[model samples]
Target: MDDLPIIELPEPYRIDEAQLTDQAALPQLMEQRMDAALQQIEQKASLRTDRHIQIMRENMHKYVEDRFQEAIRGSDDNALALVRGELKIRRADHHDSIARSEARVVELVRGILNQYDSATRVRQE
Candidate 1:
């Protein structure tokens, strides 16, 4: 062949047993990592939000109403004390920063809702 261009062959790929073993362990490793990640996500999601504050306030109010009713009915003091204790513990465990942030979010959302409500009212008018 006259004036032919020369081409070099590429090297062949190789696989090792250690690499294969590592590859086999990958799924289990990934699962453990994913579980940790999910736990972290759950913890973060469990942080108080505006809705949580609203719910807590509503629940506290309901508890007070129920306790009032119970008092009127002359219900067991021990049961009332237990409930009060549980509520106290929950309140003590409450994150003030989260609550404050939630309050701010509530105010912002309320303002937005009010704006939308006013706009709709005006449109209807």
Candidate 2:
């Protein structure tokens, strides 16, 4: 209550002394004031509640988006690892194929050279 600002009443305000002494009407007047205060409080409470709900919804959306991005990153990493493994296997297979081809070529060349030497010797004899 100390934090509340003091409001100054406007000029031209006159109090009717008879209204203040009317004991019979005091209860009704008090009830009307209480009802108005309650209505104002309810309006403020409703506004605050709506604001809190909006904030919660926004937070939930952000959290879900963050989780989804994390999942995508995990999936991407797994896929990259799998591709690298497959590439390594294919490279090893290619190297083995090249080695086998080279061996076959060497064997064929040796056979051709031997046949040529035997033919030359027969001609000389």
Candidate 3:
């Protein structure tokens, strides 16, 4: 065994080169990859044990309901209507903020993937 010839393994391929050639395409590719990854993760995640998602949903609903109730307290008929309208606007704003936060999270995941690709390419070379 000590006299055996050492075989050189082939170098790993870099996916980053294709990515770098068309930087604009990177975001689209990353989005598709991230979407697939998230789907895979969702499929594998233990839904039965996912207490945080349920808790967060319940908390948000309770918070909104509490706010609406507070606004209507000691209010006349017209004031109640005004408060209800205000609650709707606040809910819409909250939804928009959630959307923005989700978008940011997606971007951050893509950034991490990009960094991983760069590091992998460097290591391969």
Candidate 4:
């Protein structure tokens, strides 16, 4: 490190008369920069808020749709149950009617047999 040649240093920085007068405008420049920074921050915050609101709206819409679908499914289930019950009742009624018809046929056959037996006995006598 000591073998390196020495480098000449440049003169120190000095503010000239014109530059010193420009210092009077420093407060205005600072204020403008602060306002611009605040505006950018507010714009970013507004964008985030808008995105959050949109996400919430979408979730709410999906929730409502899901509930609607559930309600429709429940209604369909109830309707199916009602139809099944009605079919069961109708089947029972049909069975009862068939049983009554069979009983009547048996009674009619017995009555016919009785008439035939009585006629035969009278004819023999």
Number of clashing residue pairs, candidate 2: 0
Q: lDDT tens string, model 4, 21-101?
A: 779888889999999999999999999999999999999999999999999999999999999999999999999999999
Model 2 TM:
0.70
Candidate closer to the true structure by TM-score (higher is better), 3 or 4? 4
Worst 10 residues of 4 by lDDT: 7-16
CA lDDT of every candidate: 0.87, 0.92, 0.87, 0.94
Write one digit per residue (lDDT tens) for candidate 3, span 34-66. Answer: 999998888768674477789889999999999
Error of 1 at 26 (Å): 0.5
RMSD per model, one decimal: 37.1, 13.5, 48.7, 10.6
Model 1 residue 59 distance off true place after TM-score fit, in angstroms:
9.4
After superposition, the stretches of candidate 1 with alpha carbons farther than 4 Å from their true spots are: 1-12, 49-55, 58-125
Cα lDDT of model 1 by residue, 35-80, tens digit: 9999988877777565698899999999999989888767667778
lDDT tens readout by residue for model 2, 22-113: 76689988999999999999999999999999999999999999999999999999999999999999999999998999999999899899
| The candidate that achieves the highest lDDT relative to the unseen native structure | 4
What does the lDDT read for residue 15 in candidate 2? Answer: 46
> What's the TM for model 1?
0.33
Backbone collision tally, model 1: 0
